[model samples]
Target chain A: MACVVLSLVGISAAPAAEMVRIPAGDYAPPLRAAGEPERVAVAAFLLDERPVTNADFLRFVTAQPKWRRSRIAPVFTDEAYLQHWAGDLELGPLAPPCAPVVRVSWFAARAYARWAGKRLATTAEWELAAAAGFTRADGKNDPELKHAVQQWIAWPVPAILPDAKRARPDFNGVRGLHGLVWEWVEDFSTAMVTGESRGDSGLDRDLFCGAGAVGSRDPGDYAAFMRLALRSSLTARHTTTSLGFRCARDVPEDSSP
Target chain B: MKATAWLCTVLFAAAAMAAPPPMEDCCKEAPPAGPVSARSIYQLDATFCSDTGQCLPLAALRGRPVVLAMFFASCGYACPRLVTDMQAIRGRLPAELRDRAAYVLVSFDPDRDTPAALADYRRQRALDGAWMLLRADSGAVAELAALLGVKYRREPSGNFAHSNLITILNPEGEIVHRREGLGGGLDEAAQAVVAVGKGK
Candidate 1:
């Protein structure tokens, strides 16, 4: 199943219309690694730049009846937390719903994506969309497109973001990955750097510096620290700033099946 | 001898009549070990000895009901508050259950809470016959505390560092639920016991 990045207006826009997709297998990894063979199809769309506003989330809450006045587990007990995420929002003449939403926990983000008939983009898939990489939707490579994209990334983020929806002609299509609010990704089980789960929860004693990734001494493996600290935080815990999410989809099974 | 025997019977009847209602809902775990029809508590088999009374093995409560908790008779703050909490929970139970359940308050301050002290504490709570303030040997108390995951450390200021919590055991000697912090909702706790008692 190809992940569709459609505009809320149902427009599939200019650069995207002209763009050809490279078949899923075209991009090669920089570093050879285990689990590389496992393919995770990712599809993401450009946002209107800022995180989705409170109004956008409110639409989601209203659509999904079960989310209203929810009885989330202990992690969601904080009343203030519930209100912040479930802010009062209605369509406004000037208010923007297409903007990104912030102050969202990884749990909350995952729930919202699931409710919306989509899945979160794994970090690799997200990187592929954001950074210079082969277009894996079709079996083709335009080196000119790849070079131009690399050059644009090398260019410092423009003082003004080129409209994310309108992919720059010099580069392939994607928007708001770098310098935007940190996006929550899937693969919660994988630490960012080492790609391993961390900590001593009863559920993961085997990975508790036991037999797994604990053997690494390089300081770059500090992703474990970030993962464990992130896990300790309550599910509903979120600051009203600087956190958001994008989504992905599994390629159609019939295509492979 | 017949008149004396009659007098002894009368006194025994009076004592039983005046017994305090048992403490219900002590030392329990929730999200029961198996299915979730209705029960919610973790249970344990414990033996509580009154400071001077014989050790009462929890097996006796199997087929009978009981409530259990922790305390140091010498505690000045939350410990006394816990007694009030447990008593409130007891008052809410049906009298039939009230008569069947045993309230076990095992003392953690063994160095100072002797059997005599426990008896005095029981009287203060007006336990009459409803509950027993137990005083196990220091070793026994430690062993009991460890099994329940209750921790207590005496502070220099005389106050104890301990959580105010309650445990509920079913009539079958299994813990059905637990409520932690001084913010326990006892009525909710009672429901936990009844659900377990009925084996739901």
Candidate 2:
């Protein structure tokens, strides 16, 4: 066990995980109340090229026993957290070391990011980064990117996941932003779609104070709507087999490597 | 030089593995005598500052039935009503349970609702010592809100759009009941607090 831990540490120290710069841009929130800004300005930031891998998480749990699957507090996560792993320190067959770590609650993900000296991307930043195409800044007009996103949504997740590092890079050289997994953002709770879609057009003012005069910017954008719906449906402690997350950081003024 | 660096990394990793789990800033206080319940919110290690500027862990509220809600002091619409509803629940409780219960309001706007601001809010609301107005950093506030299943967002206008929720916690810090969306649930919520307080 000691040798295994040492080797994993060695691997992580070999090269720091790649981070891609997402240039400053604007994010159009898919759904917003009437008085909300139409487009939110997002500053430039650094986002991890791929999601955190199982091996990386194994190292974290090995060092921080409180966060280990068996030791985590029930209030922080549901029963299914890291249920796929064989044991506290072992990934086993179901979760390949290189595969993106899944079944992580938002709190657990945030802790991992904090440990790594980074933070989860916000909804606006994540949306801005994911909006890029393979060849251009705007993915909305790119037929190929649109087709890939739609295709991925139509398919069910395979029993065993593939290597996260192998995903194709998008325009900003960031990979797995769309086709790999549903990522957790920093302010996911802010996506306030009421439980009943029928009442979403006009939010229930009683249940959610000041959720006034809400409307979708583009109802035809099924992907954005789906993301918003998924976010809204999740509680912070809830985790799923298909959900994972990547970290983001502020770009320093001098841009040191 | 490279080999030395690798050896240093190995030693650092070993030291980290051997050390106790990292504690949050608010966990410096001596922990409670025994293990908290697995499902208890007191298991959270984050600290919060009361309106009086005293820092304390959530565990400090243990052994007292607590009526808790998350609100921003500047909220114009639902927050005032939420406080009123809480007071009404306290009114409904049996006299013994009423004085024993703790009324807690945790702020969502950490940037705006400083300890002083929370103190001002206490004065404005005429909340007495039994009522605890608390504020913490954004990270700690977010974690507490997550545990309570409260969702809030700061709008561009600086007011918060939030879920109106009132939670009842037993002496052990486990949630016994939750009143969602305000108004009518006060009777049931009060009964829940009574039940938990009397150990029914």
Candidate 3:
């Protein structure tokens, strides 16, 4: 009986090192202005292995009353914020403790990252990490990974999400970079798309200054295009049913876990 | 003991009923010392530095109507036009309402636009005391831009590509009106300021 109790405690405490180290890499943005570089360099960083879960966010809202569903300011989130939860402090049938928390606004996600002593990954870092294949560093040439990603994109989200921990790990031992949910990056508002696909060839110059020179780099990368479209369409206070977030940290100087 | 308590309550009620209601103090400059409204931008806890190098919080502007925009000084296009548009809005307001409103400019390039730079820009633009030029750390600037629905990106050439928007905030620090795509809407923005100032 004592051994079983000890093992249970061990299971609960195992998340201490749940972050995976992503190596320094380069990310090519799908869209860029004429003067902007094609590839942006990303430094080494620590990314959470899975998305932040319902149980994890519950502890945050409970400890910080300002973030609770009933108490959060309207400026930080819309009315749909945390609409899936059973009550201010309860998770209903639709939400499972281990499932990635959804329906959270960008402001709420940013505040949670600050509380966790981490930050939302920049677009360059996130794209670089997500570019990896399951078995290789560059997923662009991996047919199997490409097929899996396309299939996931085609399917509709399930009514209730599966456990975030169940997602398969990729080359860098990170999970849920794709085929789970859309995420909030730190600079999502920088996407700058004009909403009309044809207008993207030369962004609406009147609406956005210096955007007249912007154009797409790769029309064949459907997945990256979709992510950019979603990001540009969003306002900071808006939340969707499938939108969630994970945290990232700068790798420590000493390199110790 | 019960009779004594009942007598005390009756005496207190009689005294309260005899007193007149408190007058509304129209000249009061400070906001009430309580929680801000749920939708107020003053709920943001970020601090900013004015052109004069004074540290100021968003809450400090709580009691006045604010006409705010985000821009950088070195931009050769759009930013100069945005400032001129703000000046137009200020001109449209009645002289009485003009003096009561605050025109604020926040910089997107925190790295380059220090307090000294902002002060120089103010002097060149000939902005009066009613105008405030402010800059903050990048994080605070990003948060404020996000709240105002402004999208901006720094170019390799050190210039910024940003949305052309000017926002009018009421005395409570809630966004009351927005003028998008520039060169027009100065009349409407001035009307909004007048409405908010008069309502207050």
Can you write out model 1's per-residue Cα lDDT over A1-257, one digit (the tens) per residue? 13243233222211111122212422222222233333334443322222334454555656543343353322322343344332343433322344455555555565666555565665455545544433432212645444544454456533222333333322333345444445665533233122222122222221121112122223331322333345323232343344566555565555532
Q: Give candidate 3 regions above 4 Å deviation.
A: A1-17, A195-203, A254-257, B1-26
Candidate 2 lDDT, tens digit per residue, B1-200?
Answer: 99999999999999878856557423432334688998999978789999898999999998788999999999888999999999999999999788879999999998899888999999999999999998888888878888887777888888788878899999889999988886898999999999888833
Each model's interface RMSD (Å)?
18.0, 2.0, 2.2
Query: What fnat does each of the candidate structures reach?
Result: 0.00, 0.78, 0.75
Weakest lDDT window of 10 consecutive positions for candidate 1 chain A: A13-22
What stretches of model 2 exceed 4 Å from their correct place? A1-16, A195-203, A253-257, B1-32
User: Across residues B59-122, which tens digit of lDDT does each residue of candidate 1 receive?
Assistant: 4445545677888887765777777878877787777666556677877777788778888887
Pairs with backbone N, CA or C atoms under 3 Å apart (clashes), candidate 3? none
TM-score of chain B of each: 0.70, 0.82, 0.85
Clashes of each: 36, 0, 0
Better of 1 and 2 by lDDT: 2
Docking class of 2: acceptable
Candidate 2 chain A minimal-lDDT segment of 10 residues = A195-204
Order of models, best TM-score first: 3, 2, 1
Docking class of 1: incorrect
